[model samples]
Target: MMHEPIKGNPLPSRAQAYKTVAVIGAGSWGTALAATLARAGVSTRIWGRDESVIEEINAHHTSEKFLPDVTLPDNLMGVRELSGALAGAEAALIVVPSRSIRSVARQVAEYAPDGMPVAICAKGIEAETGYLMTQVAEEELGNRPVGCVSGPTFAREAALGHLTAATVAFTFSQADRLKPHESPAVRLAVSLSTESFRAYVSDDLVGVEIGGAVKNVIAIACGMMTGAGFAENTRAALITRGLDELKALAEALGGRRETVTGLSGVGDLTLTCSSTTSRNMALGMQLGQGIPRDNCFDGKPVVVEGEVNAKSVTDLARRLNVDMPICETVRAILHDGKGVGDGFAQLWARPIEAEPRAMDLSFDHPASDKDIATLAERIS
Candidate 1:
């Protein structure tokens, strides 16, 4: 296990200072990641579409909304123009909210050096395109090496250097497509065995991504439980049902079943649900406590992935015949005028069958009754 040595200069010699790692967006999470790279000795350059934020980092070294009180590293530079940040960067990490993925990807493609690896840390689907951020990355940044970063990291916590772990998703068919690069920080690096933080790499990009997108909706349900004063039993049910929906989606796309059980899967979901800090979960709790769903995120000013993804996921589940009971209920509560209590009542009233009926819609089989029965028995 080779660890990055501690000193005035860290990072391996072969691992040249992210020779300018560009991050699009200057929010709390974006700032935290940029700070991480800077601390890792990677001369990180952050792009702020808003000149004021760039000026703030350049002048004050603190973001009032995101990372206040902690001064940003002196090595960190924030550029007002997108091209300035992307011009010579070997790699770029997109940390803009999921809804803004396409716009930022296009900017990078237009501004960055040719074929740079644009790693996407924004986790969500394009509600209009029905495409994950990676899909948008391929379309927007043609020929760019694409990778994804996701896990149970909260912006403030990761910034404070609390231990955390995440899976890095790289796009390519062959295993060699996912190897270590002396430059550009390639290959998925994991700090496993640490109590607080770590990461694991996987080829199951599709499963890991879709689960990351959909889990927010489920996490909101858990938040509703906390806000509504529900018992732990209620919260456990949401987590269990949420995992079922995630595994079903993972199987639908070509992801290894085991992948959904890992960090980007069940691990991420549990973190978001059990805690009140997650914006998405917090949004749901507010809604359950009688706040308008719109008011739940009224002033946040960034796309909450769950706010955009829940409907998209529910639509996908319906078309694919995947029975995502909890997801469907959450969608209804948000959009269909169904009160949280009413939604729970409906879920509890549904005819109780074995749990396998929840996620085994193997799009491979016939949807007919006899075929369904056979598939059900086989899965059971």
Candidate 2:
């Protein structure tokens, strides 16, 4: 049942939509998604291990622990038991932190009804395996159709009914893979989209997920620059170069370059790097303000994804032979305990190169006076 307003655009009717969607986390993102889904008229149930948060959502339609200022939808139900959340749900959206996703996926595998489509909304590479979130979901939830929901979304803003867009990417040929059945991508996308929340569908699942993961790491670098009093030009340079790195990594991982230029790529990158509301960027700001790594967290209760993404992104880049200096430098500062100033210095000291469509040209431009002098000193 496709609702085609135009020849190419297909929309799903209310009768075709999934009646119940199980949101597998109670954190900010999860709550926001649950609220959005409920507002869109879908029956949504949010699951969390914290019984208190569940009670709060059920009784007051608020999630103070995560979204302190926002009130959730009245119809959005909260459940503590995994089985109860998944009992009659047609889809499950995993919004837990990446570190805990595998465990959650394991639970879903055991509890979720067979053939329910799973969408991963969290954005980060798995630290232990360096696998993308979609890959992790696919591995853990064997034979199930997997998809990704990611973009430049902030939980608070989206919860406030602000205009937002995201990429809804499912694996290509999913119907064929499922064999003798309909693919959930279109139905899921239509069901998730609303007046304020728009969903752009694609098949480049890897590229979309890559943009979500790498942008967090880049946002940290941009935050550090801001914290250190760097001007806008420096931030722009970093953002542009970060795009190059993202494209390189995406291509290496078999994703399309155009995907890196889409909403999930440049759009998400710009929003994350420019805003302090992002947890990763905020963490970078603290580090850039000369705060010790140990003291950066102080009182924040959030899991800053960039902290873990730095290591996983850099490791994956190295394994794929992709050049991502900004991400590498972030990993050094965050994991190697390298000083921020020194890291920036090393980044600025690298030789300049020409840009191309692929940005892969390795030829260095004319050597700087400093380089020439250093070379001369070595020769002498």
Candidate 3:
């Protein structure tokens, strides 16, 4: 489905939303988003299995382990029980690790209010099933409305209330859209946005999810370049070529190519690849510095999603017959026991070709200016 603009009532003021939201993880990203919602006057509850973390959040209003030095809002609380978190939530955001998405979503489907919109904030392909985050959500969450929230967000910066914009992709069922009810997509966008956090709504769920998943693998490659003391030009080339790989895979999976050029695709890719704060990039950096894979994430509390996603994406590309050399190289370095240097050598050994059109190319004839204008009008 195409990403049509959200059409419905103009959202009420932030103070008037009066929403209570459930965030299904107490990790850095989940906590940060919970804080954002609470600061926007929405009552927010974060769920976690760790009692100590829940206690710290409720009593001290801080997540010292994941987001140290960040103060949470008064209205943001933490719950040890998932049921307690979902009891009165108008919506739920699944922010757990990508690998745990299916399990968490099943629990949410069991407890969350009927018809509650669930926003998937996690970003990775399931290593075991190769399912995108949204696909997993759909399989486990049943008929619940599903959306994806992703972009160039750093948890610390977002918690600090720095201006951040993210792509929010949701689609209404045809039956729901034909009814007299307001657009759930619009409502989700309004409920999730804060003064400093903006959401650009889209209907390209596949593109949004693919962008969020594949960028991590590319970030690992970029980090390897950085750790190997490569110049900025090399990093820039990787970023560009990495985007090409992303576009190709996303399109092959039935996603719109233009969606990849949006916030969830190039935007997230640039952020993850350019920063040491990205856990995936950091993992790659450690590998480049001669650290073994087992020891790379030794003291880190957070999961390095790219390490697992590297193998998943490579598998997916192979299944789809998509060319993703960067992701393949990442998979080799992380999973195939290939040395970082050797992986780079393999990538450099590939033959060159003209840049392939990553968008849909089923047209049989060239288009005139009038045809181009008509196409633009239709898309616009």
Candidate 4:
């Protein structure tokens, strides 16, 4: 849900706002953001390692490699060097893959100005450390104000200048400590918002990030059902049940269940699960259609995050003793060599049970200090 307008100091005018914004990662998502920011009149620079992509974006104002046929704004610059992207930029958006977040953030720390606000646009749990994208950013960019942007956004649609709404959750812990308009979330939201792209601000950073990360795994399950030619009602039931699992896991991680129903959770889940545009869903669909697991990524260029996230999300759920059968099943199929058909059968074979009560989904014990500290740490 979009947040109510909070009373505080007014935001700076666009003319007075940050003039230039750096968007790290020139993939589809990153390119889309750079285009949006440039269209919004913010001089935007997108950084990537792809020589052809950089040339296309700079010479032709297009990212043909990722966002084919979409014309980018003339003001949007593409840079091959990290320093060229971050140098003198007021804010940065890290849109790299989940696994590369820590490395990208480390580079940003070395190049970006001190105290520059950075927004994490990646969605996945770190397979090695089980850290959210924002957590990885925070640890690496220690002095930077880290935030997260998530929702049901598709790179292609957004790049095409289609309407899009997203949640921007900041790291602020106390609403009473800072005025609403003065908050990091609000500032970043303003920096990214445009007429076509709307950003809703929230303080529930953990909830927002958790919702985005776990939903991809669920999307895979939904895709499998679709590939198997299941009925609409069956898919709907899976989505609803999958949401309960998401809520339980979020609550266990010191996040709110309500966030599960918000944009990052149900909203993202709906968009990802129902469409072939989502790489995760497409992967699941292929598996459901009897494609060999080993041949799934035969020619894919980019990483399908759900394949990696399935294991990480399930592992985290297990550590917290959270029941996430759907996600676990996905993890098994994707990682443990479990057949897709067998996985689906196991899910259906489970005994029917009563739907969980609201209280059942709620966290029984509050998040302890130790738990919070552990969450902050990166496992070696």
Candidate 5:
């Protein structure tokens, strides 16, 4: 069921005023979001490079290549011309591949209306520059408000109108500018939320983006465990420990630790790791089943973001001096041709330490010293 905005707390005139949105990229994720906005009664245009995909979406209200068996909203149109997609768009969503973010942002910069808000829906660190999706957008968009929308969202489920939640992280300034008669942040939040899709606003852009990116790598590790015949106990251990690594990297990158504990963090991690529907997990499953990397993704149009993210995350972790054993192991297996058995053996060979390493809790907590002592005693 779609959630109605709080009854008495109606949105201001301007907050409820947006009429159209442009979605760049015609992949499953992009199409799903476009369908969502169109269902919300907003005119949505999706830009795709392929003429066939555009024709399929326009003529049949479906993108069979990316989102099969799903009927899109009639209000949703697909455009082959980038300029046409952005011509009258009130806001834009960039849903391209991580590496293509810069080029797409440059196009939006040239074609989009001045000062239009852009939300990045892609999640990954740039392999060459280590830039997060929003960072790349800001660099190329030049003063345009760039935010991020991320969580544990599967395109198929979202397109089917299943309940979904996502975090929208934007700067205070961006939030302020987006506001009309009320709180800008709240107004921006209202603009994005739909009956079935809920948007939570946060200022921790780095944490949200990091969680979305790094969880794919961890999901691959969990898939490897599944393929190796490890039980749920092993998967549980990886999820817990992987979260610790996620928190460490988020903090090192100047994000609040609590952000990793939210929807975009543990929520996304759990979904991706536990589901074979995840492209990354499926790719890892192939590797675990002894399939070569080249053969793993044969004839697939969707990108398995984790395969590239493994290298990027490991590189970022090293640059920040954060310990990420699992991510590093994934990097070795994917990029260095390390055997799966050897990778797990290497991880098991490492010396044991405190469950939550002391360094992992470097961030100051709100608990009183007495509270900490009580918690410690309970654990002991």
Candidate 6:
């Protein structure tokens, strides 16, 4: 039962133009966004590694298996091969899961032409390599104008026409045929609002990228608090204090404190920690509810970005001499089998003092500038 999306949101009168945008991968995030761009009438094409899924989307105009219930426009084209998708595409939105990014990049490098923009949309830390996804992007897609898209966004919400926000930051460029994308695709672009949904791009891509990964670990700790039935005051205290530990690690990794403050950092942290949707939080809750560790993720796509990131962040924290107790606690809970109550108690017994000495950078950068939101949040 697929029908047209009610068409309430005003269509972009910009002649519904997309020179050529190809989305890589056909997972929920990739599929949802492909539908969004197609609905916006962008000359959009999506590349899926799975041949069966590609056939379904191309023939049905709906990605029923992964993103059921959403209707894709007839204009949307699906291809089983990457070379076909990359041909003539102005931009390629890379949406493969974090772990698979490197392999996919190698594939992309084989055919990706020179000077095109690649938007790295999927999130996570590469457990094996420890390099952020963008780092791999650079290695695989050499010198091609690069930008990163991140923030507290889920595939389903953004797909359902819920007002959603994200950040897609890139360096200033000057080249013909690649005249910096005068505007971003309409489905999700950078804009600010104190209410509803908004996204803003930043030049502090490393900082923003690190913040997105590090916060997932703390969200797991917050989930543990929910499982413990701690008071609201306790949860708030955990989040703020956990953020300090997170900030220290972020600075050590060359990420600005302000980047951690915006959507990917504080914003994403709040969304994942406080909500039932977060698999990391949900895992913590189940552990609190006495579910056995082996039984937790059986036959499910339960990915706790923090679970893997805890190790990465912890390693980075130790390397840089930063203190991060909450993160360590999560590691202990998941790996050492330390009781959740013990972990929480250990956190509370620690010392309280004046805000620890932290690095300071000049504030007051124009949000109009790329690094504005990321910098402001860190310097606060």
Q: Tell me the whole-model lDDT of each prediction, alpha carbons only.
A: 0.74, 0.85, 0.82, 0.82, 0.83, 0.70
Best by TM-score: 2
Per-residue lDDT of 223-336 in model 6, one digit per residue for the tens? 777776665786688778877876776677677788788887787777777876777778877776666767776636565667888887777677678878888888888878
TM-score of each: 0.84, 0.90, 0.87, 0.88, 0.87, 0.80
Of the two candidates 1 and 3, the one with more favorable lDDT, higher being better, is: 3
For 231-269, candidate 2 gives per-residue lDDT tens digits of 699889999999999999999988988889999999999
Instruction: Kindly indicate the candidate among 2 and 6 with the higher lDDT.
Output: 2
- Per-residue lDDT tens digits of candidate 1, residues 232-347? 89888889888988998768766767878888888889998988778888887887777776566665564567876789888877767777888888888887877777676556
TM-score of 2: 0.90
The residue ranges of model 5 lying beyond 4 angstroms of the native Cα positions read 1-14, 174-188, 298-302, 359-380
lDDT of 5 by residue, 1-380 (tens): 12334555544564563578899999899999888888877788999888999999989998889999999998889999999999988788899888899999999999998878888999999998888999989999986778888998999999998999888787665335344334323444666578898878787789999999999999998888777667699789888899989999999999888889999999999999998999888887777777777787674565789989999999999998999999998899899977786686566545556676773333334556565455433322
On a 0 to 100 scale, what is the lDDT of residue 42 in model 4? 86
lDDT score of residue 118 within candidate 1: 78
Candidate 3 wrongly placed segments (more than 4 Å): 1-18, 175-181, 297-302, 358-380
lDDT of 4 by residue, 1-380 (tens): 34444467554433234678999999999999888888888889999988788998889998777888998898888898999999999889999899899988998999999988899999988877878889888999988889888999999899898999899888674552345666667766776788899988777888899888888999899887787777688679888988888888888888877777899989998899888899888888888877776677675564788889899999888889888889988988888987776676666655555585543343234555465344323110
- Pairs with backbone N, CA or C atoms under 3 Å apart (clashes), candidate 3: none
Off-target runs (Cα >4 Å) in candidate 1 are 1-17, 173-197, 294-302, 357-380
- At residue 237, candidate 6 shows an lDDT of 81
Distance from true position, residue 254, model 5, in Å? 0.9
- How well does candidate 2 score on lDDT at residue 294? 66
Clashing pairs in 5: 2-195, 179-184
**Clash pairs detected, candidate 2:** none
